[model samples]
Target chain A: MADVPTKTARAEWGTRFGFLMAMIGAMVGAGNIWRFPYVMGNNGGGAFVLAFLVLLFLLAVPGLMAEVALGRYTNKGVIGAFRDVVGRGGMVGLGVVVLLVNIALMSYYSPVIAWTLYYAVHSLLFTFTQPGFEAEPFMLGLFDNAALMIGLHTVVMGSIAAILALGIRRGVERIVVYAVPALVIALAVMTIRGLTLDGASEGIAFAFTIDWAFLTYSDTWIAALGQALFSTGLGWGIALTVGSYLREYDDVPLGGGVFTAIGESSIGILAALAIFPIVFAVGIEPDAGAGLAFVSLVEVFPEIPLGGLVAILFFVGFFLATFTSGLLITEVSVTTLAEETRFTRTQTVLGVCGGIWLLGLPSAYSVDILDYLDFVFGNWGLPLATLMIIGIIGWVMGPERLRLLAVNQNAGIHVGRWWNPVIKYVIPTVMLFIMAYFAWENFGTAEMIGGMLVLVLFPIIGYALMSVIEGRGEQPDTADLTGGDD
Target chain B: MALTAEVIGMLAFTLLAFWGIATWSLVRTLRQEDRKVEILKHQDRMDTYSPESLAELREWIENNPNDPLADEARQQHNECVDALKHTDMHYYDWSSEEIDRLDRV
Candidate 1:
């Protein structure tokens, strides 16, 4: 009798392009569009770029490679990955640490996506071009109207939930392949338009002028470090979760590490080109904060030629950037819970999105709550997740094992021994430094206190919860901790 | 206002470093994927590791035979060796002499 082939029902990316696009879409958020440009505008523009590039190569590149390799090597989501490494005990709680942080981040981030969605709709209406329109009051009106904010938040979460319910190929991959390219093209068009404007060179000079002094300043490095790490969404479990769905014969190092690290950040450079030239051309005082995108850019839209069309391109692209991130950020939880629980994918989507929406209410009701959570999570929670994931790969599983097993397996570019030390020593050290530096900078403040609480409380909560479930030994551990297992 | 040569130079450097490298990696990886798919269509399986990486895997398996992942690594290394000997086309550059020298762990 002839044996028939049996294909597993496992959902993988339909194509390599879909997987690549998903990484870019998940990493390039509203921060890449606005926060990066904002920081660059303030720091010596060219100097900041120099600092950022150095750190990106040293830390984010190798670090991301390690994170992606661990995911592909294990082919599991956060918690399962931890169990695979640590032999199915309380130590598996480390994965829960990552999951909790991912959810916490999405809770506030979903509301921010809602903000962009609101502006994207208005930009479609050419609201920025309306007579007697005020950018400040327009922004304030949205921020102040709690009902509208909550409604927009609900809408954003609903859209994300609907997309996620479709599963990986039909859901996330289908949207990102189109959305990511559309985002790049939109920014590219805006960049061309901005560059051709009068006084555009002044904006360019303001942004690209290398003050050699900034390279000497610690503050410049600090700003660049923050932009490089946070802006790339390193550790956050987004990359790991995305990496988990990698198909057989997929290369992790090149696509997941090099391409993703540099590719998503390239959008930030595009953003600076798109926004600053337009701002200078209109003689608007450049504000290098979140306000620049929401308020300052809105003001400039009325003054430029074909400004209404520009508004459409910028806001729509901005919405795509944040919305895709929202989808993936929430997917980290959806992927993990769906694995751990007996629930269906559709059920997981509803449960995760509902939880995010509920946690997001306070953030949705007020901008202050959003900013507060952003600082806390951005400073401590994310680095903690990074520490957990990279720490496990570095110390527990051993970087050499993962590198040989996954990183160099069909890798586009060969990664040498240099990556091991970076993963083992460099990344964890940098993560610790980032958390400590931020704490020292904001010492004794409420934000600092909140960050401290997260650092302490999250691990305790994760350990206790996992201990109760796993200590009972309801299932066999079956953890393969051969070579490199510490 | 006239632009300084320094600012222009910085802008050029940043653009080349970010977008230039990004475009290169994206194109290269996608091309690699295409090559892999084409190879798999012809052969049941393609070589999973390069010469250097396969050697590294073999060395690792030899050095740490007791490691939990050693069996998996050895299997991967041997699979690549088998594919190299049997397949006409290869993903990584491998000479017939190199294929002859290969052995299962």
Candidate 2:
């Protein structure tokens, strides 16, 4: 392996505290708030939770730690880091896969963040508290208002761009340090309020009740695994990019990787605590799908005490979770561009944000496009990239070697030898099984076909365009591309 | 009724405890970092040692084999010599000043 240069100036996280908070902020997002509750409601609740915890510890934690180890060890963005780790050949292809995945995800994800922002402001203005506020029609109205959707989209993307342009310490770290704590506090308050509601125990019992029969269904296992993976931000290269700024001495095993997983999972449980009690107290159907947060919760709020204030708190919390996540998602592209090209950070941020804004128009204008993009990126692209990443770490690099060199080297708590078999065999086997199951179940639909085409074609086009750009000699200084000073 | 109150109390306590632990950990990390910086500052001046000074010290140690301070000089010279290799292995291009600045956190 060629030695990475030692003397290129790169930004580092201000402190371990800042790094941990930023990572926790990245993991605890809209998935924890809206998606986790409904998934638990639809699945077997306590049984699903058990399976999710099992998959998280066995598969997601190791995968997350591996990505973090790769980033910290290489001290470069995904492209340069992958190039260094995987060596010269196949770097561009793998790099494009990781890059395009993040870009495509952010293209759709920003519109959702815009939705939360609009709702947060709308709630604060007492709009939801108005007489006879119809939740479904109102939500549909907002979605169909093209001007408003695009405006909120611009606002969300612009805020992320402004924060990222401030650099790591002043921008990302400062916001997350406050944002994560605020999110938890808001959730705790809402949880207390929900639990205090008159008929809340039924919801809590339903959420925590165990039904072993559901474990027999493979669908339960797949949904649990999907939630665990997506909720923890595995295979997204967002963690990998965040880990790139980690100091050499920061611990990966316990303080960095495992801690982030625990924090994120705990927040998911807390979200269930906050949401289920209210839903049960109001006697709403728990399996409300994507509308569980906006429609169902909005319906429940009007019938309860302090419901207006609680609604404001919930939407505000949702906004914080989503906005912070959008920041990290966009940072992946911003950092890649800044490191790869001769462009200034400002130019890179604006260009990336502007491009995403234009690309996200379809998702903003139509719910069908939004759902389709989410299905393509979420189900197929994310899992495929994650499986490839795990394969690289396991079979290509040798799991034991990665553990020794990347993980245990600077870690505060070293993983046991059990990690070897888990990373090498168990995680990859489960991931392959999940991918096969998804393909078997969803492969025939028109949406699936369209998703598959986008999944196949987006990266090939991205890789080709990237190759052309690299060939045109727009590459930045090699010294800068490598970590450290020239 | 008592059990319901107990459950609520327990849940509230657990949440508060977690927040307390997070705050304590942050404080402890900052304090530990401060101690590390202080120790690094006083332990040795190797971070500031120049190449020419290192070479001169090595030669002095070699020539003054019987001198009283020769052992200490040799130790300092060896440390200075190893510093370059350590720098090469570092992940970030952190200069001594930047390191000091980081320590201020």
Candidate 3:
């Protein structure tokens, strides 16, 4: 029997230009700049880079296509899409996890964005020109002043909310058109600047240099796979959620590939340029963890002539990067509201942003707790959530049917037939293995494993409870996972 | 640290705020859905029988028996006066606007 074809409510993009830029902005973020270089340094640089590219082709892009297709077809947020196809119980589990992760993300993420604002203002005021140009002092200057940090963070959050409040077409898509391109230009400038520096050869060498032996370590592969997924914003539901707004007529598979490729390569190159030159110039080790972005780099800023200007641009760029990620993070929650409530666009925006703001406090104030939470949510929670998304859409969606959806989405674009195999078997298997491997590698100690499980599983368990409360007990329709095409 | 009255008060206030928003949104959603459902039911009932209408109605009833107007059509079909002979589309005429409206809702 032919089901009635309802009008698929496609949320309009501000423009085709806005659509492209916003998608790219969502894809590019701090991971490309702050996280990529540091992780690359630790792993074998060239070898890790090679495997990462391969993994992106094999697992990440196809998985991304499935998500985009699901979102676009269903025209709903993560939970709404999941529930409509998978039933209420399946949805609750996914929704609660997504909500918790977005909340945790904003908590510390806002503070980091605040840090960028602080640096931007300091650079503009030429505050760093004061004689004492040392890392400890500069680092102390920003973090110690909580009030300053809080104010800037608030300003950044306010700007982000104001833009989101304008609705998707005007606010996000329009602003991102400029923001993303400017970000790319800034990165290019930084890369050129790095190359001109006296020690830039070393910086270039540091990035491109290979450690083939390092590839032998399974942990390196695991890290590379995770980085590929997380850095591209795969496990986050941000891409899928945003892509849900796209019209069915748009070529989704092509959009997915282009977004993923540009995001990965640009961020990869920009991160290398931004970090390696500074690290090489200062004689600092390239492999220092998260601290490299904040602590070590600020120390070197004072010696340069236009140190303040450079710092201002660098941090401003970071702010944009984080802001892009943060907007998507907030969007995940806002979309939940759009699906669950009849609140107008404005109300839903405020509701989600405000909710995140309140939830964000604990992480902002405490680094140690935030670190623990970040590990649990970013590393473990996101992968688990993404795995569910893939399985729900891939296997449960009927393999043949899902392939047809993929083909339909790729009508004008050329995604080879091989995409089906990757989405169905290769991607999910790789994700599962990496997730398990990371869990094993990180959770070695019994106490550590137990504590991590408690933290991560609490949200999952709570979601299950919510599902029972709201769901009308029904098995998820594995056959119709893309919520059926009209 | 031990729980204090201040902390308890804050928790209570937060809970109230969350509950208030959730309840407000839920009511609004349910109301909107109800309005849409009512419109759909009305359209389904007002539709008449024709050759095209008979085919479409038969398909709709067969596929969507749970739809609100399905019972009305069932009663009409089962009426003693209009037994097997009048069941065909020749007995009734339907307007394009009516059919379009039925399709819309």
Per-prediction backbone clash count: 4, 6, 0
Between the candidate structures 1 and 3, which one is better when assessed by TM-score?
Answer: 1
Please write out the lDDT profile of model 2 over residues A99-206, one tens digit for every residue: 777888888888899998988998898788789899999998988898888888888888998999898889999999898888888888999999899888877766
lDDT of 1 at A349: 97
**Every model's TM-score:** 0.97, 0.81, 0.75
State the weakest 10-residue window (summed lDDT) of model 1 chain B.
B66-75
lDDT digits (tens) for residues B8-96 of candidate 3: 44334422432333334334433433443454454422212233424433454567566434564454433312322333221224444
Tens digits of per-residue lDDT for model 3 on A274-379? Answer: 6687667767676553466666666656655455666666767776777876777777777766766678667888877776666656655655555666666665
Residue A288 in model 2: lDDT: 46
Clashing pairs in 1: A482-B67, A482-B68, A483-B67, A483-B68
Q: Best to worst by TM-score, what's the order?
A: 1, 2, 3
In order, the Cα lDDT scores of the candidates are: 0.89, 0.72, 0.61
Per-residue lDDT of model 1, residues A1-486, tens digit only: 245522224578899999999999999998888878868978999999999999999999888888888778777889988888877777788889999999899999988898889999999999999999999998999999999999999999999999999999999999999999999999999999999999999889878999889999999999999888888888988888898899889999899988998999999999999998999999987875558888999999989999999999999999999999999999999988888888888999999999999999999999999999999999999999999998888887888889898999988888988888888888899899999999999999999999999999999888888988888454536455523432
Write the number of the candidate with greater TM-score, choosing between 2 and 3: 2
Q: DockQ for the candidate 2 complex? A: 0.04
Best by TM-score: 1
Interface RMSD after interface superposition, model 3: 22.3
**Interface RMSDs of all predictions?**
1.2, 12.4, 22.3
